[model samples]
Target: MGLNGQIPRCEHIDRCPVVEHGPPECRACLALGQSWTWLLVCLSCGWVACSDDSRGGHAKAHYQETDHPVVAALEPSSTWRWCYVHRRNV
Candidate 1:
């Protein structure tokens, strides 16, 4: 997560899965019991995955494979998101 503020609309905003499905969809947590340190929601397809700080860093892998740049934090009350393409929080 980065500074709190309004996130400018980006190209992936329409397809971001976080807007459609919440973080409970994390497959890594369901399948591997991976802890959700900084839970991530795929912006490309909405597939939730654990953060790099978690057991598998599946979130990063998801981006590597899918090239989906934006991911919303799954923690309660957190509205922070990251952009892999920009290498910073958007």
Candidate 2:
């Protein structure tokens, strides 16, 4: 997702995560002693997970398990989100 325009909401969109900046790091990364190129945050539950680029792929797994369609990049500088169901920027 590009960093411009109004971000669309996914079915699982919850509250504005703007209050808290993206998580400092991917929890799964630390837990697995793995490095993550990108982090993904579950908007509905605030679950910190890793992107598919990482070995864990925890974020994508979380979506598959929880049906949580909404996830934003956990990088502090990233301002876009992705909808797993629609496979597009949200």
Candidate 3:
């Protein structure tokens, strides 16, 4: 299924203000000089941030901060996405 249909009403979608600029800057990853590995879809407010700072820990932080779970690799080649809370692929 396409993302539109696969991902139901992600609450974060409206709350996410980062999408306005194409892709939000990977704040967590930029600090570490490591390119972002995944696009963390905020469950609380769909803010797409880079995974972890040094490879995608920020994504986990979002999970830690908010119970919302679900993240996808920003890589175009990747179609696999995961939900941390659900502990399953979406």
Candidate ranking (TM-score, best to worst): 2, 1, 3
**Local distance difference test, each candidate:** 0.73, 0.75, 0.60
Per-residue lDDT tens digits for candidate 2, residues 1-90, read 335765555544454354343466777679778888777788867888888888889889989998877788876688788888878886
Candidate 2's C-alpha lDDT? 0.75
TM-score: which is higher, 2 or 3? 2
Looking at candidate 2, what is the lDDT of residue 6?
Answer: 52
Question: What digit string (tens of lDDT, one per residue) describes model 1 on residues 13-54?
Answer: 555653465547568677886566667877667778888888
Q: Model 2: which residue pairs collide?
A: none
What lDDT score is found at residue 4 in candidate 1?
Answer: 81
In model 3, what lDDT does residue 70 have? 62
Residue pairs with clashing backbones, model 1? 17-46
Q: What is the C-alpha lDDT profile of model 3 across 1-90, one tens digit per residue?
A: 448667454443334344322256667567778686456555445556776544567777777787666666665577666667556665
lDDT of 2 at 64: 93
Which run of 10 residues does model 1 get worst, by summed lDDT?
14-23
| TM-scores of the candidates in the order shown | 0.67, 0.68, 0.51
In what order do the candidates fall by lDDT, top score first? 2, 1, 3
Q: Which stretches of candidate 2 lie over 4 Å from their true place?
A: 1-23
Which candidate ranks first by TM-score, i.e. highest? Answer: 2
